[model samples]
Target: MSRKEQIEKTATALFKSKGFSATSMRDLANALGIEAASIYSHIKSKEEILQRVCFNMAREFFEAIDAVEAKEGNATDRLKRAIAAHVNVLTQNTEASAVFLHEWRHLSEPMHGTYLSLRDKYEARFREIIRSGMNNGEFTVPDEKFAALTILSSLNWIHTWYKPEGKMTPAEIAHNLTEMLLNGLTSSKQALHDTYSHLNTP
Candidate 1:
């Protein structure tokens, strides 16, 4: 990895474990087996490292949503894919996920605004999918934002409790989450039929 990548990797772990304020330049330098001042060669300050870590996580989050959005399918399928991709990336990248979930609030005003803007953009992807599903008569949610938030909240919480090596594989977890979210948001006959078939089977 490049020096900047190494710095981000190390900083992500430290920030997740120690939080932004509790972690220091000396801590990162010590962890990387370099002098405190050597870190300055790669990054201007500790805040820069935090910014990179946050940006890295944001990039991953948006990329996952983009991948799902680019898929060829109905809005429901796209939403399912998006939820699965979100969980897969967050669970597989624990440090980045943690940095995203817990450390984003530490960014300065300008940086925080930038982060929030990207976050809103990414979230709009989900809301758009939900709205499309509703307009097509595939979903029956009363509030689009609340429904989208419901799905996002469920998927976002995977970073907190999901384990890559746990009993369920990523595909299984994703399917369960997609099913959970879709069921709550949509009351279409097709969805009810699928649920009935699954629930009544031997």
Candidate 2:
């Protein structure tokens, strides 16, 4: 890898562990066995690294959503596609993604505002997908916002515990998560008992 790429990679890990505010140029350089002053040749500032990590990961998620949305599929299939894409991105780029998820608040002025707006636009995509499902009689939810937020909340949490050496691959994790969100945990045998029959009564 190039010197700049090595610096960025080390910076990403530091940002994930110590946060953008807590990590210093010295910390990054020390991790690379180089003088802190030398890193400036490649990066202008700490925020620059944060911006690179945050915006690049954001671009990835936007691309994933765009790809999923463009495909020919039912609402259920589209949601599954989206979930898989999300998990895959997180698992593949864990450190940078963690920074994107947790350290973005440290961004300055116009960038902070821009990031928030971008995030809202991204979330709106989820709301539309859920609404589409309801319109097509494929999904039933009391509120579109709530359902979208719940799914996103669950999916984002995976980044905290996901491991490259873990039992589940990214695709398998996404499959189980999608199944839990759509079909729920009730097995066929348990569902047949109709224990909650009163809830279904007219």
Candidate 3:
């Protein structure tokens, strides 16, 4: 990694563990085994690091959803892909994901608003998918907004408990989770049975 990338990576770890407010440039520099002055060469401020981490994570999520949206599939299949994509992004970028999930509250004014806007857009993509499903008679949810919130709330905190060395891969976890979430929205017993059986299969 270049100096800039290395600084961002180390800062993300610090922000994840120590928090953006609690972590200083000195601490980040120390973690990088360099003088505090050296860090300034690569990063302008600790908030800069936070901004990079937050925006990069947001971009990743948007990209993942964009891929799912572009694919040709039924609502169930599209939603499954979306769930898997989300899990993969979180697991693959755990440290940054943690910082993004928890530390973003510390971001300054305009950037904070920008982050919130991006987040809303991301959530809207999920809601759109769920609404599409409901329209097609694939989902029986009474409220698309509530269903979207439920799915996002369930998946958003995986970084809190997910272990890289766990028995289940991200894809496996996504499969099981998508199955469970979809079960609640599925319109009929046959759909639920099919999902249940597929989830149980080796």
Candidate 4:
């Protein structure tokens, strides 16, 4: 990697482990074995790296979701793809994903506002999938908003404990999670009970 890429990569790691507030440019430089001032040549400020990591990861989510949404399927299948896409994005780069999911709060104004806008927009897209399912009689949530938030909440929390070297691969986690979440949202109570009971099996 080039010097700039190296700096950004290291910054992502620091942001994940130390958080944006605690990680300093000097600390980043020390991690690279360079003088503090030298990093200024490639980075204007630490928040610049924050913007890059958060926005880039956001782009990955958009790209994955866009492709899944455009495919031929019912809302149920589309949501399955959306969940898989989300899990893939989180698992592919846990460090950057951790920083993206957790550290964007430290961003400055304008960028922070922009990130919030993008965040709401992204959540809205996910909600739309749930709404679509409700309209098509595939999902039976009383409140799509609450259901979407709950589903995304559970999915987003995966990053905190997910380990690539753990027993479950990304696809397995995605499939199992989709099964559990879908079981909850399905319109048929009998099917929901059967699927959920099976999901709880060892």
Candidate 5:
């Protein structure tokens, strides 16, 4: 990788671990095995690195949503695809994802506002999908907003605990999460029981 790419990658890892507020330029430099002064030769400031990580992640999420929308599918299938895309992005870019999830608050002024706006837009895409599913009778949620928030909340924190070497691949985890969210645990259990009862009838 080029020095700029290397600096951003190292900074992202540090921001993910020590947080944007706690991590210093020297910390990033140490991680990169360079003099702190050399970091500025590639990037302007620590905030610039944070901006790169945060905005790249935001761009990725929006692109995923756009891809899902461009496809010809019902809301249920589209929603599943969205979930898979989200999980794939997070798992594939764990360090940047962590900083995007946790370190964004440290962003200054216009950046902080911009991040929030982008995040709201990202969230609205999920809300729109849920609302569409409800309208089409594919989903029966009492509150579209709440359901969307719940699903996003569950999916957003995967970076905190997800291991790259885990037995489950990102796609499998995405599929299972989609199933559980789209069809509740108890509802699936009840459906299985009813199916068995019907089969056993004389």
Candidate 6:
């Protein structure tokens, strides 16, 4: 791989495994089996790597939300699509998701603000969908923002414990999660019963 790619890949692994505050340029270089000075030939500094990893993960997450939000469908279906997309991205890009989860706090103030902006934009897409559902009497949530956060938090944390080599594929996990989230949010009694029974018995 090229030096830049190598740095990024190596940095991603270190950041995810060691966390942002704990990882150093020398650590990354040691992991890459290269001289510390060699990294400077391709990348500027450690913070730059932090920026790259954070921005790359943020871009993927924001893009997925945008893609789902732009689709033509009813609010409920669109919400399900959004949840599925979130789970898929979190599961498929495990390292990126881990970086996003663990190293986000290392970003600079301005970059942190930018990151929050993109995140809020994504959350607003869900809020909009939930708002539409409530307007149509399909959802009964009192606070759209809180409900959206709750739903997103439930899906976002799956990466922390999801095993790529486990019995359930990403699709299966997404389906089960989506069904549970939407059924609770939309008050689907039958779906809720099925979900509860499946979880309880299995």
Best by the TM-score measure: 4
Tens digit of per-residue lDDT, candidate 4, span 66-171:
9998899988898999999999999999999999989988988998999999888888988998999889788988888888888889999888889989999999
Whole-model alpha-carbon lDDT for candidate 2:
0.86
List model 3 lDDT by residue over 101-126, tens digit each. Answer: 88999999999999999999988989
Candidates 2 and 3 compared: the better one by lDDT is: 3
TM-score of 1: 0.86
In order of lDDT, best first, we have 4, 3, 5, 2, 1, 6
lDDT tens per residue, model 1, 1-202: 9987898889888888898899999899999998989888888887887787788878887888878777799988888888888888888888888888778898998999999998888878888988898888788777888888888777777766777678998889999888877877765547777999999999
- Considering TM-score, which of the candidate structures 2 and 3 is the better prediction for this target? 2
- What lDDT does candidate 5 reach at residue 7? 90
Listed in order, each prediction's TM-score against the native is: 0.86, 0.90, 0.89, 0.91, 0.89, 0.88
The lDDT per prediction is 0.83, 0.86, 0.90, 0.91, 0.88, 0.83
* Clashes by residue pair, model 6: none
Candidate 5 is scored at a TM of 0.89
Comparing candidate 4 with candidate 6, which one achieves the higher TM-score? 4
The clash count of every prediction, one per candidate, is: 0, 0, 0, 0, 0, 0
Candidates 1 and 4, the one with greater TM-score: 4
Q: Kindly report which residue stretches of model 5 are placed more than 4 angstroms away from their true locations once superposed.
A: 185-202
> Each prediction's Cα RMSD?
5.0, 3.6, 5.9, 5.4, 4.1, 6.1
lDDT of 6 by residue, 1-202 (tens): 8779878888888888888888988899899898998889898888787788778877877788789877798888888888888888888777778888778878888988888787788788889999998888677776999999999888878877889889998889888988888877777535666888999994
Predicted structure 2, TM vs. truth? 0.90
Query: Model 1, residue 136: displacement in angstroms?
Result: 1.4
Candidate 3 residue 100 Cα shift, in angstroms, is: 1.0
Q: Write the residue-wise lDDT of candidate 5 on 1-202 in tens digits.
A: 9999999988888888888888899898889888999888999999999999999999999998899899999888889999999999999988899999888998999999999999999889999888887787677666778888889899989898889798899998998898888885135445767999999999
Candidate 3 stretches with Cα past 4 Å from truth are: 187-202
Candidate 4 TM-score, true structure as reference: 0.91
On lDDT, the stronger of 3 and 5 is 3
